[model samples]
Target: MSEEFPIQPKFGPFLRLFLHSQLFCTPQLPTQSFADQTVIITGANVGLGLEAARHFYRLNCARLIIAVRTVSKGQTAKEDILQTVKHRNEADAIEVWDLDLTSTASTVAFAERVNKELPRVDVLVQNAGINSKTYAVSEGIEQTMQVNVSNTFLLALLLLPKLTETAKSAKSLPHLTIVTSEAHHLAKFPQINTPDIFESLNDEKFYNGQSSYEISKLMQILFVREFVSRINAKNPPSPSVIVNLVNPGLCFSTLATRNEKPLAARIIGSIIYKIIGRTTEVGSRTLVLGASAGPTSHGEYMSDGQNQDVESWIYTDVGIRAQKKVFEQTMKVLESRKPGLGYAVGL
Candidate 1:
């Protein structure tokens, strides 16, 4: 690696990206089998998460867990998969579990359930996140930051033991993949200069709906880098848990255009989606790729089908400063949710 970051993204503009999408293609669907792997995917009721779960089940993953906010929606997603894909073992092959990222209590309970019921977890796809234009709060925090960044990592860390244990017992490199976006590079991160990123983010007076999602995505990437550094902090790592962040690119997803957006915004978004977005099915392939990635991908960013260097800005002086600040502040907030979680997760 050179002093400069590798492969700084060249097509950062919308027009260039749209033209690129027009010329290139989504990730070629993975035909690799996931046999014997117990895979868990968040927000699997629809969109990328649901389609990703479908691929795993189609590839003959032994056990599939569709973690969702509502069990009913998950059931619907499961039934859709069963009807479309031919399954050999019919009953209990797929389990639906409740996971509400908006609430710390819910996040904690969900992890506890996984620890209690699941024999092992080979892959965890953190595909559930929000991109809304509305200002809302959950559990006394801004909803977007809570779901997309805070609780998301909390769930991952809470389940670290399960992932590492499965790695050792199954002789596999378990994966913990977080679904992020290319828009992270566009984040102004209005809170970066503040003494506390999370605290500043909580100041509703300064909250921006548009940049909030981008900031959260950026935070996810930053946090993953910091988290991996700690995961193997002491020297020899515990059982290998390949942690990765993936960008599915802009895709046609109903989740993002739901009531959380105004009609005008939704209409404009729909037009943009039709012009340049890949289908949810196509986008999900990237998630599957990220989840199946090997040890070399640890602490790396995966896009389309392979590891890509993050934007050069992320390696710049400004970006490095922002990264360190966000990680330190994030840990302080997360520690309250799970005391000594850094140590618990082998930090």
Candidate 2:
């Protein structure tokens, strides 16, 4: 494992971030209207994703696609957002699309629908993820690794063509924001020493559910870095699609307490969240900012509504090797699902 940072996963930085968010991290509402823009947010049925939908709606975005696993649940979220809108006519702007991250076919279908139906995609937020409390497998891989890492990028890569297409004709640069977490710093790099990190991580003997979640987030940052590099190298410079990652910091949400956590633990976590965690609305501000931020945020990891340095561990020699290895494995998995996807995205 790489040497731990003095500030990350420690009391000082955590406290500082908490205090800053409470006192200074106010949501910066967009001055420019999203009058004709199409915004798609996955896992938008609840939590920060739902709150982000509300923010986009407030900006009068033309098409707000709430992509969730359950169509009924998405409809409910859409209705909830419509209820909050001051004018009834604006309610028509919100639409629900079914997206199940665990299934590659479902993700492909969702992308196809978006390409055929939506005239353009101004923003795509990859926010659907879970921190599974127990070991489980989905689509023949560990659930956390499958949903948070592989499937997350699978969806992103599938949608790249649409984003690039939109940027070709649109006035504003298109944005693809991946919601990550500060927990990424907690990943133990030694666990991923093998050439095939994804397959190694799947071994039950070495499996640690929480650690897997952290590693998945860490991989997300690395993937964004490598992905942006590839796009920048494309001939003729593919339209200015800003690919960035955002950490919402500690937030008061049910993300961790899901999947049969003990009652006492849930109570303790709830109390801590109430005391120190930002509300979902406040935390979603960072997501909103990333989705709307300009060129400066490209390929950046943002926290507390600003660009923050990625942990030094990601820059180490070992870390760079891990990034390339994981990227290759990621491409293998994604390409197996949709043949020729990497070339389509100029990878």
Candidate 3:
């Protein structure tokens, strides 16, 4: 009876504050519906990428291609998405294909398959990434660098024609959306200086226990800028393609558990993480935004929920100044590998 006499709504003040803050906030939301657009989100078996696929489908996405390293996992994820949209108005159009972003042969093969099967890829989300304590190798390159940067770069390059085709065919030109990370700032600029990255992939003894993950992420942003420049140089003005990068804020997921830290260390880290770590759903927001939105700016680095000009953050503009060198080095690494089964540049 006393409470009823003085009932006050909790969060009333906070709600008022939020409403006031909205006046100063920037507008959000895509200009158009995602229907009829085909999006390929890598590493969609789980984590942020998986969440993106689910949300996109919920919004009645025309097609969702979930690229996974594991075939069984991919199949399972496909089934789950189908179940969710089972009662929806449109029939399910979700697909899952195998893609290992560590091997050149694998990346090329996946690209070739996509070109053959997918007439248009409206959005390409480079969401798959890896980090490690010791320098690991894949296809004669550091695992972190290769998977996060080199392999991703090769895939993007290989699919350029298809992406262009998709854009040309689409009502609205398509976009290339890449998922980089805030950890990029921690890297010592993008440099292929560490030849050990190539030598250490096969020789664990030669591998230094170092974090190449940050460097790889740095290279990712650099690669995006380079790719955009190359496309512009080769294409006419007012090209249909748009390229953008996004950094999903820190999230609690398998990426944290990947390192084999002590039990107490893990517990303490998790507790601290719980205090600040964002949910997977929140982390996927920027990716969805970048993928669906047309070119707000070319080669923009969307991080911390803000799109920062990556060109401003560079410590050394050497790579930017020497586009040809960077491109040649990347192509050299990719072409060095023997063309394995089902691997080809063009259909």
Which portions of model 2 show Cα errors greater than 4 Å? 1-24, 27-31, 235-239
What is the clash count of model 1?
A: 0
lDDT value, candidate 2, whole model: 0.82
By TM-score, is 1 or 3 better?
A: 1
Task: Compose the digit string of candidate 2's lDDT tens values, residues 209-275.
Answer: 7888888898898888877766777654444788899998788766865668778988898887777
Clash pairs of candidate 3?
136-143, 137-201
Local accuracy of candidate 3 as per-residue lDDT tens digits, 1-347: 13211212234443443333223333243334678888888999888888778777776678888999998998787777767755554434788888999777788789889989887888888899886776555666767778877788778767766887887678877877788876655544323443433443345664432446665666677656766666666666565767788877677767777789888989998986686676777677777877766466567777544566443335245546434444556666766653421144231
**TM-scores for every candidate against the unseen true structure:** 0.92, 0.92, 0.80
Give me the overall lDDT of model 1. 0.83
lDDT of 1 by residue, 1-347 (tens): 34221223344563465357444957989888888999999999999999999999998889999999999999999999888887554647899999999999999999999999899999999999988777888876789999999999999999988998998777568999999987776676656766667777878787787688888998999888877776566657543788999989888886566646667877898887887788899999999998888777899888886887676667777566666777888888789889998788777
lDDT of each: 0.83, 0.82, 0.68
Give the clash count for each candidate: 0, 0, 2
Error of 2 at 330 (Å): 0.8
Clashing pairs in 1: none
Candidate 3 error regions (>4 Å): 1-32, 83-91, 189-210, 304-306, 311-326, 337-347
